[model samples]
Target: MAIQRRGFIAAVGTGGAVGLAGCTGLGDDTGDSDNTGPEISGETLTLTTTTSTYDTGLLDELNAPFEDRYGVTVVTVAQGTGAALETARNGDSDVVMVHARSLEDEFMEDGFGVNRRDLMFNDFVIVGNSDDPAGVGGEEDIEAALTAIADAESEFVSRGDNSGTHTKELELWDAAGLTIEEFGEWYIDGGGGMGEILNQASMQEAYTLADRGTYLDMQDEIDLEIHVEGPVKDGPDELMNTYGIVAVNPAVHEHVNYDLAMAYIGYITSVEGQDIIESYTSAGEQLFFAEALSEDPEFQQYVPEGWGSSTDDE
Candidate 1:
């Protein structure tokens, strides 16, 4: 959905990629008397989400139909994944859409969120200049490529803002047996969103880990190239990136718009929603794969991916 200016504004810092949009007027019409759920009309749903979604312009296409269907406005605050979850935990948001699972699990276990759903997915890629200064090009092994980059003392840009991409970058470093704390000047911490970090990497010709969608969306604006591929390009699974949507727990924050939040969630996970996600593309490439309509979904689709019988026993 194209973001509208009527009551729509974003907390700035998604790299100025797209302007914010919101619905103009609230919907006060009550549906049929037999409807069992809360009325979402005339409500404003506050959604805290990762910058990747905002930066790639997916929200414009994804949220428009939902807003029209419900006659509600969606106010988005795009930030790093960690910051997004924190916003929900603090009762500042009605819902969240983020990609960092570990952080999401903590939010759920702490009773700040509920109704988690596997929404959509893409993959992470290691990008750098075409020269491939660290000699990491064509390597399927993400860890090895990272190690080589470190060993060569090459410039590496980090989203150090605690975003999902930052979390994945740290995971890759750990897998490579390299503590980022030990690295020298070659490591650059870019405390910004995905689009900003990509721009930073582009200007400096440094290496950075980024979601495939954001990279492709800004490909024309930046000089950086994909030095190593993620699962989307037949690389390792460690680079697989999945995003989730969860509503803030009304039990934790009664002021939150729980009804409208659930409505938004239901709309995004429905068959029509899945199709919208599937059809969204950038740079002539599909950005995310819809996961909600799978015929054989996992139990974790409704919980954390690592949850199982043992977690339940505990």
Candidate 2:
């Protein structure tokens, strides 16, 4: 049953309609024929998503199973979360997978997407040189950690590209209540992807914020150690990293394949999808922890339910 379901999902395709009336069976006059018309063919779905997931190679793993099951070709355009959201808003993609919740909410509220389902999650971690010059290691308080770094004039690399990681970094600084604007040279902005930023931080021996998945994937090449994690990584606001897959509203964009887009969304949020997410790991470490689609309290509160109240996950 699972294999058959997977096959059904992989064959789904999407395309723009000449008119909904002619394609959606609303205008069909055949009384003897089923309302469902011929299967959609040769349709392509464009997905605009975050670079972190792409850089970490998570999307490829997640999408491969779906593609094999659905027989549909998915074209992924990877960019920063901000750019991804903007692309979805501009109707350039049929679906969006991003991590910026507030921005995503605004997009949905504006009617660009029909629904946003909570996907998998991986927390951010503060990585720095092994020397630990800032003495931020094992620190659970993010604000104090940053303050120490600022006071020590420790080198800090930032993903200034408006990516989700960058957004989280800025929020951390804000929570620390330190004006990073005054600490000029100590801060470095790598206007590139997470991989590039990691390389830059390594080259400079600077501290930087990174998703756990990317850090784990590149751990061998990096001399940095996980300094701050959990709430301190993004502050006490749960600091949970939540990803959402949203279907571009067909009502707003005539070219979007609403049926196939929704189908993909449905598959991704289903139990099978969560199982796939849970199965991916790097060096024996889970890449992303699965989040149930149920209205669990922890999910509702931005923390994965049963994730424990501690700052670090076991």
Candidate 3:
């Protein structure tokens, strides 16, 4: 059974708010004659999303207008990307908003998700002590920066909870040809979320990977500085972090609320939702860049990144 919450905010309108799959120029009102879109049956939407969205407070802003327009309560569960997907796999969530594309691909491939759409994007940064103990400041290449950190044996904090940031950190280490198992006391497994990991790094004066939004939101409270920038600051493409929304496949879980899930997905990818995300800021700095309204979205927007070619080969 889905956990229910009543946070609905009634809006002043009698039109449809759901957006199309392609999501072009759609908002609260699409100027239709009847203005009555598909009937949504549910009153509560369970959204399992990553901690960065919740930590940066973007989720509340994004969900407010959505809840108001639909008159439905949005119960959000903020966890790691891995955990969020796992929750959906157990039929506990109606939709999932997350990063870490590789894990998302696995989930969709396993028939647990559908209608995956490119929602928004941000980048990950490598932060450490301001003194630059590893001497990796301003490094454009993430892999090279990781290699430098490893070579210096710098005390690095890892988000060992397998969050999106942790996934990116592991990928960077692998790209640099380094293994986590070989590391000694220099590596600290921070089995926590982004905010907790950032706080841990600050207390220990160690290095860690963090999303730009969370880092900026807590920048004043933490002593660490960004040693390597992400794509948001003209950094390498490897650091680019793209987020997507996937509706749990109703075929697998008959109890899932597919209509409400599609409505939520449509609204977020629509113009209004994109505007809300692009305008959101932490410490007066833009936290995310909207990607759904792009002129030419990749094939991966609706499916896995390489699903086409993989199917051709098979």
RMSD of 1: 8.7
Candidate 1 C-alpha lDDT tens digits along 139-195: 988888998999999999999988899998998899889999899998999999999
Tens-digit lDDT string for candidate 3 (146-213): 99889999999999987788888898899999999999899999899999999999999999999988
Candidate 2 residue-pair clash tally: 6
Instruction: Give one digit per residue, the lDDT tens place, for model 2 in 171-225.
Output: 8788878876788788987888888889899989999988888888889888878
Error of 3 at 159 (Å): 0.5
Tell me the spans in candidate 1 whose CA falls farther than 4 Å from its real position.
Answer: 1-37, 311-314
| Candidate 1 lDDT for residue 184 | 98
The collision pairs in model 3 are: none
When 1 and 2 are scored with lDDT, the better candidate is: 1
Rank order (by lDDT, best first):
3, 1, 2
**RMSD of every prediction:** 8.7, 9.2, 7.8
Query: What is residue 26's positional error in candidate 2, in angstroms?
Result: 16
Which structure among the candidates has the greatest lDDT? 3
TM-score of candidate 2 versus the correct structure, residues matched by position: 0.80
lDDT against the true structure, per candidate, is: 0.84, 0.73, 0.84
Return whichever of 2 and 3 wins on lDDT: 3
